[model samples]
Target: MSSPQDPYQPGQPGQAPPQPPLPPQQLPGNSGRAFPAPAGTYPEAGPFGLPGQHPPAKNRRKLWIILAGIGGVLLLVVLGIVILINVAGSATNQARGLADGFTKMVIGGQSSQAYDEYLDPALKEQLSKEAFIAGVDTLEMDESCKPTYNDLQVSTDNGVKAADVAGVITCGGKEVDLAYRFEGTEDLKMTNIKLRPKA
Candidate 1:
């Protein structure tokens, strides 16, 4: 029979045949083809290697130590400046105080007190208390004689030096020229004083 007329022929209203499903895709291997690596996997070689790697603890500690030393040096410099300022202030005060004391004793007619304050140990031993007091008393008794000292000016000259003291002596209302020399010690004591009448 003529193949029974193909009972399920397309033209004779028969169901179509089913097609096969597509295969799943796959990445290539190291066989001359590039492929994406799995997440979190890294290449053997890198442009720089492990981003932001920290320095060793020892190296970091050394850097901190160097900075600390520099800071300490700066601190010491500041402290030195403060100490020098204090010393200068103390010197100024001492000079002013000594000058004031001399002025008060002389103007107040306290010749003995003035002598005691101004004379150093050496001078005191050389000149007896009576002689020293007498000399100052003579100056006080003179009508035109007046002794005055401005504030002491201190300066460094190998050591410390006091400014020239101003002195005058008057007799019979005539001014008498007086020459004097003054010296001080580190402790600001008036260590030496000499007076000479002008010719």
Candidate 2:
């Protein structure tokens, strides 16, 4: 049999081969077992990857939904503004039409007819046909008094929508400023009329 210190010692029956010696770095201070080597930097996007930065599929979908919600709100606001503008414009035109019709009557020698047919009920009660005709006549209203309607402005007072139709009426050889204010723009009626000679 080989001696215990023999180089051929492993020739003994059932004896395993000797293990290679660990490196000096592998030694655990006085402890029989060695500690494992320190690990290197983490794998690509491994532990350093935060939750929502490059996010999972589900989180990405949530972000898209939030964007869509904002887009929908903006679309609704634009549509509402367009619709409001159209309604206001229609109201102003309707009120202007009423004022134009009344002005035409006064210019066409039908002041009494206009007062009976177009004036608000409350105003008609306060001013009789004679009084209304007398009012129009004060401007020396005549065929030579050419009326041209200018810009019509709009406003609201006490929940009553109104329009002020401004125009120049040449009367008695003088240019006069004419303002016809109407109320109830929805079902417009002449509320007031005034004529002033321009300076």
CA-lDDT, candidates in order: 0.58, 0.76
Question: How far off is model 2, as Cα RMSD?
Answer: 10.6
TM-score of predicted model 1?
0.49
For model 2 the local lDDT of residue 98 reads 79
Q: What tens digits encode model 2's per-residue C-alpha lDDT throughout 144-189?
A: 6777778788877787888888988876668878887787845767
- List, residue by residue over 82-175, the lDDT tens digit for candidate 1: 9988876676566656655664565467767777767667667878879866765655443334555433445656675554444554445544
Question: Residue 120 CA error for candidate 2 (Å)?
Answer: 1.0
- Stretches of candidate 1 above 4 Å error? 1-52, 55-59, 137-189, 195-199
Which candidate achieves the best lDDT against the true structure? 2
Error of 1 at 51 (Å): 4.4
